[model samples]
Target chain A: AQSVTQPDIHITVSEGASLELRCNYSYGATPYLFWYVQSPGQGLQLLLKYFSGDTLVQGIKGFEAEFKRSQSSFNLRKPSVHWSDAAEYFCALNSGGGADGLTFGKGTHLIIQP
Target chain B: DTAVSQTPKYLVTQMGNDKSIKCEQNLGHDTMYWYKQDSKKFLKIMFSYNNKELIINETVPNRFSPKSPDKAHLNLHINSLELGDSAVYFCASSHRLDTQYFGPGTRLTVL
Candidate 1:
């Protein structure tokens, strides 16, 4: 079975500090990776996705992620964190398309400090 | 504009009862999916429909059935709701291989 792991359950960073969220996936073939953000009382918004081609992909709201096949990881990063960035971040992967369904990580709760 | 939407954002029902949650997406996506978020915030896929055809059913109980009236709508009906069924249900839609847009989700509480 394909599985996603987000080692960090909770992470707190000061405003303007750098942020990184780790995601590791287990699959047999080249996987399609994605990152999503969810705000309080809201649906998840897609941040970025990596299907093929580029290993580093850019997403919305000053977010980016690097897909490292060598490490079987796709870690999300932001140069600087903002208070508004506090939310739950989830990493998902398409083990196989056409209804295989995305296997999602438990998610990481991002906290921003003043 | 609203991309995907689900009705009864909050639902509270008793055990052994039946309920249905409706979902509609205006994004013109051909694929629709239902996901569950548990109390611990763990997300899991329950079902998926493509072009009104059942494509994915992931270890879900037969008591839970999904109905797709058209390309834009998919409804979930639960029978004999149990306490374990209490969770946040999210509806999402996507094209053949594009990004999926999620709805605000319906919080179901079974007592």
Candidate 2:
């Protein structure tokens, strides 16, 4: 079965520091990869997505993700983290057509320190 | 304007009660989905509808049913809700094989 894995359960980073959240996926074929963030008491927001385009994809809130095919990974990163960036980050993937639902990872809890 | 929206942002109900959560998307997308986030913050897909037709249904309980009256609307109805059903439910919509837009989500608490 296809699955998504977010290795870190919790990551603490000081504000203004660089950050990286690891993600790995298992699928039969090249899959559609995505990164989503959810703030406390909020819905999931799309951070970035990797389709058939360039390996590097940029998203809102100064977030970017790189999709590596050989490693089967799509990792999210930011140059300078902000206090507002603390939230639950999820990595997801879908292998089929548009009708197929996404398989999400357990998610990583990001804690921003001042 | 909200691209996708869900009604009853917070719902508190007793076990065995039946309730419904409505969702609508104005992005003109033909596909809508329901995802459940547990207390542990683990998210899972529950159902998917494409153009008012059921396309994907996970290993969800029979008490849970999804109704898509039209392409722009999808509603989830839960019968005999249990305490284990307490979780946040999100509604999302997407065009064919494209990025999906998510709603604000509905938090359901069954006591």
What residue pairs clash in candidate 1, if any at all? none
Error of 1 at B99 (Å): 1.3
Window of ten residues with lowest summed lDDT in model 1 chain A: A94-103
Q: Relative to the unseen true structure, what is the C-alpha lDDT of residue B62 in candidate 2, on a scale of 0 to 100?
A: 97
Residue range B1-111, candidate 1, lDDT tens digits: 788989999999999999999999998899999999999989999999999999989898998999999999999999999999999999998887678889999999999
lDDT of 2 by residue, A59-96 (tens): 99999999999999999999999999999999999886
Q: Report lDDT per candidate.
A: 0.93, 0.94
iRMS values for every prediction: 1.1, 1.1
Reproduced native contacts, each prediction? 0.71, 0.88
Task: Give the per-residue lDDT of model 2 (tens digit) for B1-111.
Answer: 989999999999999999999999999999999999999999899999997889989999999999998999999999999999999999999998788889999999999
Error of 2 at B70 (Å): 0.9
